[model samples]
Each structure stands twice: as C-alpha cells, then as structure tokens.
Target: MIGLKPPAIDRIALLAAHCDDIAIGAGGSLLTLCSARPGLRVDALVLSGGGTEREEEEHAALTAFCPGADLRLTVLKMPDGRLPANWDEAKAAVEDLRARTDPDLLFAPHPGDAHQDHRGLAKLVPTAFRDHQVLGYEIVKWDGDLGRPSAYQPLTPEVAEAKVALLQQHYPSQRQRPWYDREAFLGLARIRGIECHSRYAEAFHTNKLTLDLAGG
Candidate 1:
C-alpha cells in the first residue's frame, strides 16, 4: 500500500461526542504525533461529559496522549445519547471551535458511527470547517457499524502497547463497560493493522480530500 504524508502538522483538532472517544479512536496516533513534534497544538472538543468524573478522566487522558504538546480541551454538558435533541448547541460549539483554530488536520467521529451523538457531531463537522483534512475515526461498539476505512496510521508495537496502558490507567470510569478492555482495544488495532500491512494501526474514513501531487 502507498502512503501519503501530510504537511507538517503543528496544529490539530479533535472532535468527539464523549470523553474517551478521541483517545479510544486515535490515542496511538496522537502519541506518535506528539512524540515526533514537541509542543504540537491539540484542540479537543467533546459534546458531553462535562461537570462529571468523565471530564476529569478526559483531561488526564488527553494530557498523557498529547505529551509535551499544547492541549486545549472543552467538554460540554450535553446529555449523553441525546445529541439529536441538542442540535443547535452542538453546532454552535463546533462553530466556536472552528473560529478558534485553523487546524492542519481534524480528527472526528465518522458519520457512519453507530452512536447517534457521534453521527450527529460528524454531520456538523463539514458544516463549520469546509476546507480541511478531516479524518473520521472509528470506535468499536456493540452496534457493529465498522466500515472500510481509506486511511491508516500505523503504530509501532511499543506505541500500541503504551496506548492500551495509558487508556487503562486513565479512564477508570469506563472500566465498568464489558467492551472497554485491553483485548477489545488491541483486537481492533490488530485487525486494522492487517488491512494496512502493519502490526498495529488506527484506521480512518475521509469523505473528501484534495491531493496536491504537484507541489507549489
């Protein structure tokens, strides 16, 4: 498989419907990016889980995920599983984030995601940020909605292990879930890696992209 390296990504934006969504989806990639570029700016926005223990977990988890980077995270108070009801509020939050950062790359939940909140936020992303490379990250869930992804971020074995370790260490509130274990996390990574001919990887689906083969 061929690979395309993005331009120097000094700034990135992460959008998720819940606290651990970003980390669960792209934690390994974040580790690779931050480790390569110290002080990289990461702006993260979550639609729910504010004013709760989940928010605390998200802050700690993102700090570890974006080590040595400038990480700014906002977790709103939208009720979980009710994003369709709070459409305007969510759109405003996404618009505010767009106004603040012109990121080189954006990580967001895929529109085809099984969760309604994820799908709702995915729909809003393109409305605010019209011109940007948006990678739609996938989350493993009981809904069984995983699809064929077009982009792959290969992770080294050490990085993959570290990603799992950090996730387990940081998100104690999520430990109660039957699917939130190392096996589930690494299992999905392993499958994605096979698709990309790597030992471990995080995959993404992009609805649109404009490649520049002829450099300016």
Candidate 2:
C-alpha cells in the first residue's frame, strides 16, 4: 500500500459521543502523534459522562494517551445513547469546540457507525469543521460495523501494546464489558495491520481529502 503523510499537524481535535469512545477508537494514533510532536495541542469534546466517574476516567485516560501534549478535554452530560434526541446540545458543543481551536486534523467516529450516538456525532462533525481533515475512527463492537478503511496509521509493536495497556489500565470501569479485553483490541489491530502490510495499525475512514500531488 502507498503511504501518505499530512504536510503539517501542529494541532488536532477529537470528538466522541461517549467518554471512552476516543480512546477505544484512536488511542494508538494519539500515542503515535503526540509522542512524535511534543506539546501538540489536542482539544477534545465528549457528549456524555460529565461530572461522573466516566468523565474522570476519560480525563485520566486521555492524559495518558496524549502523553506530553497540551490536552484540553470537555465531557458533557448529554444522556448516553440519546445523542439523536439531544441533537441541539451536541451540535452546540461541537460548534463551541470549533470556536476554540483550529486543528489541522480531527479524529471522530465514522458516519456509518452502527451505534446511534457515534453515528450522530460523526454526521455533525462536517457541519462545523468544514475544510479540516477528519479521520473517522472505528470502534469494534458487538454490532459488527467495521468496514474497509482507506487510511491506516501503522503502529510499532511497542506502541500497540502500550495502547492496549493504557486502555486496560486507565478505564477500570470498562473491564466488566465482555468485549473489552486485550485480545479484542490486539486482534482488531492485527487485522488492520494485515490490511495495510504492518504488524499493527489503527485504521480510519475519510469522507474528503484535498491532495497536493505537486508537493508544493
């Protein structure tokens, strides 16, 4: 597979419908990017889990995932699994995030996600962050919504293990879920890696991209 890199990525934005969504979807990519660019600004917004243990978990999890980057996170109290019903609040939250940071790249759920909350947030992303590159990260779930992703961020074996370790470490509350295990995480990464000719990777889908083939 041909590999392409963004010309510049000094800052990034992360959006999720629930607290652990970002970590489950893009944690490896975050680790890869932040470790490479120290102090990179990361503005994150989650629609639910504010003022709860989940929010606390999200803060600690993102801090660890981001490493030394300038990570600013907001977790709202929008009812989980009810994003479609609370559309206005979610939209305003996304718009507010847009006002605060002009990230060169964005990570969010793919529009085809089977979960309603994830799919809702994904649809709202382009309405606000028009012109920015958005990488729609996938969450492996019982719903079986995984699809063919065109973009891949190959992860070193060390980074892949670290990502899984961080997820298991920071989010104690999620361990009870049957699917939330090392095998599931590593299994998906390994599959994506095969798709992209790597040992491990995080895959993403993009709706639009403007290429600079001239290398200007």
Error of 2 at 134 (Å): 0.3
**Model 1 stretches with alpha carbons more than 4 Å out:** none
Report residue 117 deviation for candidate 1 (angstroms).
0.3
Give TM per candidate.
Answer: 0.99, 0.99
In model 2, where is the ten-residue run with the lowest total lDDT? 1-10
For all candidates in order, the CA lDDT equals 0.96, 0.95
Best by lDDT: 1
Per-residue lDDT over 2-55 for candidate 1, one digit per residue giving the tens place of the 0 to 100 score: 998888899999999999999999999999999999999999999999999999
Error of 1 at 51 (Å): 0.6
Residue 143's C-alpha lDDT in candidate 2?
97
Q: State the displacement of the C-alpha of residue 156, model 2, in Å, after optimal TM-score superposition.
A: 0.4
